[model samples]
Structure formats: C-alpha cells, structure tokens
Target: MARHVLLVEDEANIVEAIRFILLRDGWSVSTHSNGATALDTIRSVKPDVIVLDVMLPNKSGFDILQDLRADPAIGNTPVLMLTARGQKKDRDTAMAFGANHFMTKPFSNSDVIDVITRLCDDPT
Candidate 1:
C-alpha cells in the first residue's frame, strides 16, 4: 500500500507545493493549517508519517510532538519536522522531543522525498 503522510503547516504556498510533490510521489497526503486540530485529525487518519512545522497557529510543533508521544496510540508515529528555525538548538530540541527527522525551510524537494522514502522504509 502507498504510504500516507499528514502535513501540518500554516503557509498556504508551502503546503500546496509539498502536497504536490508528495502526491506525485505516490503518498496519500492530508493537510491542516492548525496545530490544535492536528492531533485529532491524525488519530482519525493514522498516517504513516507526519510532516510538521515548528511554528504554527494555536500550538507549536514541539507541543504537538509531546502530545503525540504521550499518547500510546500515536506515540510511535514517525515525524519529520519542518521548520524555518535553522538554529542548532531548535533542531536538537526537536530531536529530543521525538521527531524522527528534521528539515529546515527552503529545503530541496528532492531531499524531502529522499528522507521520507527512507523513513517509510524503516521497520519501526
């Protein structure tokens, strides 16, 4: 079966671009602009992977990651954090919070695709 990816990003243009790329790569993509609704939506959809943004309205991606990890039903879900914050501290914090991978904004589509491919291939 094709992998499913949940994308939580506030930017319309970036969401559209990433959606286009993920869909073209055979991923089932679902998108939401609000982090507040992300957890509920994810529980319902149960995506194979999540592409989350650190800065979001209602809640931050780190908060969402914490919530996800706290819930046994969704705790093990792989997350690829997308952020405009390129600082090492931000990346380190995200990793410590359970994000499976991290990518800064203005990232290459090829890199995103490659990482997601590898993440989905892992036996976790």
Candidate 2:
C-alpha cells in the first residue's frame, strides 16, 4: 500500500515544497492549512504520517498534538513537527506534546523525504 502523509501547514511555499518532495518519494500527500479543521481532516484521511507546523491559524500545532495524543484512535500516529523558530524551546515543546520528530523550516528536501520515509516504515 502507498504510504499516506497529512501535511498541516499554512505557508504555501512550504506546503508545495514538502508535497513535491514526498510525492516524488512515492507518498500519498494530503494537505490542510487550518489547524482548527486539521483534526477532522486527519480523522477522515487517517494518514500514515503527519507533517505539522508549529504556528497555525486558529490553533497551534502543540494543541493539535496534545489532542491527537489523547485520542486512542490516532494516538500513536507519527507526527513530525515543523517550526520556523528553530529554537530549543520550540523543539522541546514539540517533544513534550508527543511529536515523533522536529524539523525546522527551510529544511532540505532530502531530509524531509528521508524522515517521512522512515516514519512510514515504522509500525503503526
């Protein structure tokens, strides 16, 4: 089965970049820009991996991660949190909220593809 990836990011450029990278790597990529509706999209899509942005409209990625961790259905879904800040505090917060990995913005295409590939290979 093709691996599914849910990309929750507001920035258009980042979205396009990650989408292109993952798609080229043979992933089924779905995108959501609004954090408030992100959970609904996730539930509906049931993606194999999630690429989430830290700052979002309506709700923050931290809040969404907390909610996902609390839900039994999707609690174990691997999440890779993205942040433009690239600060230790931001990375630590993502870890505390149960994100499986953290990557800063302006990330290398190779890195994103490689990480997503690994996350998909991990057993759900």
Q: Candidate 2 regions off by >4 Å?
A: none
Residue 79 shift from truth in candidate 2, angstroms: 0.3
Q: Kindly report which residue stretches of model 1 are placed more than 4 angstroms away from their true locations once superposed.
A: none
Give the C-alpha miss distance for residue 74 in model 1, angstroms.
0.8
Model 2 steric clash pairs: none
lDDT of 1 by residue, 18-120 (tens): 9999999899999999988989998998988889999999999999999999999988889999999899999999999999999998899999998888787
Candidate 1: how large is its RMSD?
Answer: 1.1
Tens digit of lDDT per residue, candidate 2, span 1-124? 7889999999998899888888887789999999999999999999999999999999999999999999999888999999999999999999988998999877888898888888878733
Clashes of each: 0, 0
Deviation of model 1 at 6, angstroms: 0.5
